[model samples]
Each structure stands twice: as C-alpha cells, then as structure tokens.
Target: MKLTRPLLILLAIVVLAGGYFYFADSSDDSGQSNLLVSVKEGPLLVTIHASGELQAKRSEKIKGPDGLRSVGLYRVTIEDLIPEGTVVKEGDYVASLDKTELDEKIKESQTEIDKIETQLDQIRIDTAIEMRGLRDQLINLKFSLEDKKLSMELSKYEPQAIQKQAQLDMEKSEREYAQLENKLILTREKSIAKVGEIDASYRQQEHKLNRLLGFQKKMTIMAPKDGMVIYIRNWNGKRGPGSQISGWDATVAELPDLSEMMTMAYINEVDISKVMPGQNARITVDAFPGKEFQGLVVTKANIGEQIRNYDTKVFEVIVILQEQDSLLRPAMTTGISITVDSIGTCLQIPLEAIQSDSLSFVFKKTRTGFIKQEVVTGPSTDIDISIALGLSKNDMVSLNAPSHADDLEFVYLDQDEKRQMIQELENALTRRIKAQQVIARSVKQENLQSKDTGGSTFIIF
Candidate 1:
C-alpha cells in the first residue's frame, strides 16, 4: 500500500485545494445570508429621543433672610436644614441659619442702649435738682430786696442822710434781684435742653438694638408653602462638606410643587428646529423602569446654550408631564421620546438597508441576484425609514451586501449614519449662522462708530 514519492506529492496538493475551495464556498454562503431582507409597507413614526432630568415648573425656593445688610453681617450661613425630600407644610421649619453672630450683635447693642438709658435718667434727675436750687436762690434774692426797701423807708423818718443811703442800698438790691431772676430762667432752659439731647440718644440706641433683634428672629427660615424639600447646591457651587448655603447669593433648598412636573432635556442644535411646542411625548424614568408617563412639549429655548464639560451647544426643551406619579421625583433621569411626525402607511425598510456617501440608495433583490436602486427618503424613526420614491410594498431589499453584488457593500452605519445626516445639516446651518453673525457684527460696529463720530463732532462744535 505504500505510495511512491511523486504520488504522495500529488495527494498533498489535492487536499490543500479541497480545503481552500470549501472555505471559499462557505464564506460565499455566509455573505449571501447577510444580504436577504424584505421591504414592506407599514406605519412609520418619526421620533426624537432625548435624555434629561425631571424638575418642577414652579418651585418655591427657601433661602436665608438677606441677613442684616450691615457691615460684617450682609450674609448668613445655613446651620441646619430639613432632610432633603421631606414633605413639609406651610410655616414648618425648613432651615435654620447660624444665629451666633447676629445674637452677639444684638446683645452688644442692647447693652449699649441700657447704659445710655441709665445715663439719661440720672441726667434728668440732676437737671431737676439744679432747677430747684436756682429757684431757691431766686426766692432768697427777692426777699432780701424787699427787706432792704423797708429799711430805707424807716430811715427816711429819722435823718435825710440816712434815708438817702437806705434808698441807694435798696436800688442796689433791686438790680441784684433782677439779675438773679434772669440767671435762674436761663439755667432751667439749659437743663431742659441737656435732658432732651440725652433722651434722643437713648431712643436711637434702643431702635438700633431692636433692629438687631429682628434680624435674629429672621434667622429661622420657614416653608412659605406646602411642598417637598429638595436640597440645593451650596455657595461653593457644590453640596458636600465645606459647602455652605448663603443668603447673599440666594443659595438654599427648593420647595417644588410635586403636583406639576416637567423634564428638562437638551436637544442637539441640529434637531432643535424639528422639536416644536405641543408635540406629544412618551417618558420613562430610569429609576423606575417599566413605568411610562405621557407629556407634551411646552417650551423650546429660542437660543442655544453650551452644555457644561461639552463643546457642542444644545437647546433646552421642556416637556410637561400630563399625569402625576407618586414615585416621580425631581432630578430623576428621564428618557423622553417625542413624536415629531407620523404617517399611516408608507414603504419603509430597516435603516441598515440604506447606503450613501453623496447619493442615497439601497440594494434591491433581482431574479439574478441583487441590484442597486436609487431612493428618495422622507422622515425616519429609530429603526426604519420611509421611502417616498423608487420603492414598492412588495420589493425585497438587502439589509446588507450580497456575495455576488459588486456595487453593494455592508457598511456599519447604525448610529453613525444618523449622526452623519445631522452633521451635514449642521454644516448648512453653521454657514447660514455665520452669515447672520457677520451682518449683526457689522451693524453693531456701524452703530458704535457713528456714536463715537457724533461725540467728536459735538466736542468740536
């Protein structure tokens, strides 16, 4: 049974050829299987999906009182806050601000006020005593004047020289009495004025102390309305230790009305125009899977804003929930699918069926194999796309490339194709946007130059 050397070499060549042909045929079969897909007529719903967080449309923000608005007391820090997500009633304690500083200020002011009041009382008493002493001196002066006059009259009966001396002495006493009376009146008026000044000072300090006490009372923040509490980011722009809530910047907790809720989503700038108010939407919370809610687009931002930590700009779209759920809470992640357009019947195929670079086309099955057919596409959903022309309900199309087809090739364009379409639209939009920006800048510059020129002319004139 042993074979010769030439026969052995021939046998090896035959085995290698057989293995090559078997693999080649197997690959061709696998490729053919990838090509076969059916094109059918069905309903196509064009939708735009966006992810965002839930929030209340109207929230009652509870912040610390704008503090004292005085030097070193313009802001207050939150010392205690009710647990987040706690349901609170109106007038319930929401937060308490640090009262140490304000309390100390009030104490100092009260002490100063009390000291001033005591000084005022003593001043009033001293003024009264001084007035009484002045009155007594005045009475004494009047009596002495009367006695001198009587003596002068008695001397008039005895001797002319003595009577003349008595009269002169009485005139001197009259002058002294008049001067004493005037002095007593002036002293009384001066004492009254002094007491009034001290009393005014006391009143001013008392009012200041009362104002400080009022600030102390304002340190405790109460819920203005019944709602659930949601803790807010602190002054340091975060919510952990070392972060403190402040009244100066209005950083505090939010009391959001749970009855009305909405999800705030950022739509890509390219898709912003497609989203409109009043469009219906279906929403699902990531935390509560299998639970769905309905909503409508209530608002779309007229201007686009850049998302933090991202370079692309996005428009904020508000979707109001039509039904309220007890499990739904603010800040929960939401998956929103908005129905922008829908059609009753249309010739559609899987999104994978379409192939394009500059032109759009799909591979149509033929009796021989498969052939390329140009297509006109309309609105598309996440999976299937609507063909407006060049397709029929019974037509069979390849979702991928066939083994024998040369023009058709399988291209992985699952999400990439959608992004490409958006990119192309964005490019067109960017060009138009740039043109508008240029014109706007030109107008602004012209206005500014005109103002400057007018000012110069006025100065020259």
Candidate 2:
C-alpha cells in the first residue's frame, strides 16, 4: 500500500502505544492470586520431636582395671582383642592382657620365698645343734654334782675339816648344775621363736605369689553375657596422637544386648520440660525408611550436659522401644516424635491459616468471599493447629490476605452485602465457564468455516 512518511510514523506510534497498553494490563492481571486453604476435621496430635540415636537399655561396659584396682601394677597391654561387631556367647573370651608382668612378679615372689625358707632351715639346724650342746653340758654338770654329793657323804666319816670342804664343793656343783639347766631351757625357747618367725615370713611370700598367679590367670577377659561386641571409642579420654590406649586409660568396648533397645535423645532446655517419662512416642530409624516403631519415655536426666564446643545445654531423655526390630542397631540415627498430647477428633487447620495471638483470627471463606472471623484455638503443633471454636468442618479460608485489602476498608458486612457478594462471585464464575464454552464453540466454528472457505485469515493488532 502507498502511504506518506508522516502517516507511516503516526501509524507506528499508534500500534506501539496499543501494544504497550495491552501488555501492561495483562501484566497487572497476572500478579499473584490469593492462596486459599480449607479448614479440616480430623485427628490432631501435638508432638514434641527430637533427633537421637539408638542405644541399649541394659548394656555392659567393657573396662580394664584402673588406678588402685590394679594393685599398683604398671599399665597392662592388650595382647589379643576380638574384632568389633562379633556376636559372642556368655563366658566367651573377649580379650587378653599381657601376663609377662605377673609372671615376673610371681618369680620374684617365689625367689623371696625360697630365700626365707633357706634361712628358716639354717635356723632350725643351728637351733638343734645349740640345743644338743646345752643338753650335754647339763648332763655333765649333773654328773659332777652327784660326784660332789658322794664325796661329801664319805668325808663325814673321815674328819670334821675335810667333811666341811667336801660339803662346800658339793654346794658349788649343785649351783653350777642349776645354772646349766636354766641356760638349756632359755636356748631352746629362743631357737623355737626364731624358727617360727622365719617360717611366717616364708608363708607370707608364698601367699602373695599365689595371689599374683591368680591375677595372671585372670588376664584373659570374658564376656559376661551373650551380645554383640562394640569397640569403645574415646572412652575416659581421647587417645593421644599416634599412640594406643594404655591399660590405665583403656575402655575396651561394650557388650550391648540388642534385644532391648532405647533411644538416647538430647532435648534442649527449652523443650526439655515438655518431655516426660511414660509419654507415648513414635520412632523412625533413618536406616529404614517408612518404618516406625513405638516407644515410651522411660527416663529423663535431672541435670543438663553442656553441648560440645557450644554454649547450649541439653538434657538426656531415654525412650524405651516397645518393639524390637532386627534392623535396629546401636548408634543408628533416629527421628523421635513424642506424642505429648493427642485428641480423638477436632477441627483443625494449617498453622499458617490462623493469624494473631491472644485473640486469634482466620480469614474464612463465605459463599461470597473471605471474612476476618474470630477463632478460638487450643493446642498446636508445627504444621497443624486445633480450632476450639469459631470454625466448622468444610470451611474454606485464605492462606494469605488479599492484595487490595490494604486499600479497602474493613467494615462490618451487612447481610445484604454478604448475599450480594456471594451472588456476584457465583455470577462471575458462571460467566468464566460460559466464556470458555464460547471460545470452544468459536474454535469449532472457525474450523468449519475454514473447511468451507478452504483458506484462513490473520488479524494483527
């Protein structure tokens, strides 16, 4: 078509202005629509959730003798240890300690005992020899006394002076014999006491050696019950760099009975009060998806432990598993949902559906539109809340406020206005459905027309 330059420029401007206005209006209408949700009626459970790991409720700790218990012996080393994760029976060997120290101590004690016994034998021999010599001296003194006595009797018939001298000699012999007899008795008693002392010391050394031998036999540790062996890690304290645990610091491992399992959950002080013993709980092991186990809170800590490298404090809570599973293992991570409270049936809604506190409100949908309705709420959880009043089943509510709500006045709606709005909404929806139908019809008609015309036409704005 032929056209002037000024007219062509005016036409381009008009087309560009029309296109801009159309696109701008479409963009405005394309802004986010209101998100709506429905108030529901169902079972609402208020739960306190925590994360923890599985542990044995009744487990035995494998530990070596520590200070004072070791009886002043040097650190004992593990000569042989059973591998971790081995299932063991009662009285089965778990590990063995080096017995070289005990053997050396026993030998030393035996040597000491031998030395004492040798001294005791020598004392016995010397005492016997000394006692024999003392007896011989006593016998000789008695014989001399008898001879003096006989001499005194014969001198009585000889002369008065000679008889007196013989009597003096007899008296001297009698005194010497008495003195020899007393010395013999004292020597025997001293020898007996000395022998008894040496024998007592020898027995004491033997007893000590026997005790050491017993301990040496005890060097091999045995399992007290049937359970799985779990090697302990960083017990009493952490291992030094590039060094193994000494017997003094060694905690060998644990024998946990897998039959009875419990969860060791740490709850922060904020939520700790809400958890209590005998509370019903549901546990989900991370290792097994979609499987849940039931449990009860069995224990709670009175004191809180400081979190590692953090300022927070957490109290340990034990949840006893009601059912045992073969797949459940100690130290496996688990998700615990403790049902602190539960109600059979109630009106509930998403947590986001309710607004405000003290006097709560929800935007409930009427047949017309949404209205700010006052609501009474009860216990709530992270996702669902129980509506005690001011709501009913099948009630729809807006999850968010309307875009134009700030511009509109929040006036109380009269009965007539509510009815009018409901009618308007219904009419609008009906019109939308009709419009869709008309478009479908138009497309069908166009197809027929194109078939009749055997061609098509394009209209551009």
Residue pairs in steric clash, candidate 1? none
Q: Considering every candidate listed, which one attains the maximal lDDT?
A: 1
Writing each residue's lDDT as its tens digit, candidate 1 over 1-461 gives 35688798999999888754533232233445644556788887778998988876556667666645652475566777777888989999877778777888878888888888888889878878887887888789789889998998789787888988999999998998888888878987887888788878888877778777777777788998888888664213333223454435544677777787888789988788777666778999999989999988766778898777546898878788999998889889999998876667778898999988576888776554556777767668889988766677877787776665565543333455556655654564466456534442442111110110111111000
Q: Give TM-scores for every candidate, taking all chains together and pairing residue i with residue i.
A: 0.65, 0.64
Query: Candidate 2: how large is its RMSD?
Result: 21.6
Would you give me the overall lDDT of model 2?
0.70
CA lDDT of 32 in candidate 2? 49
Which residue runs of candidate 1 sit more than 4 Å off their true CA positions?
Answer: 1-36, 57-73, 87-94, 118-187, 190-194, 214-228, 232-256, 394-461
Residue range 23-139, candidate 2, lDDT tens digits: 322211237456666688988777888898887655576655444144446566667778777899988988877777778888899899989988988998898888898888888
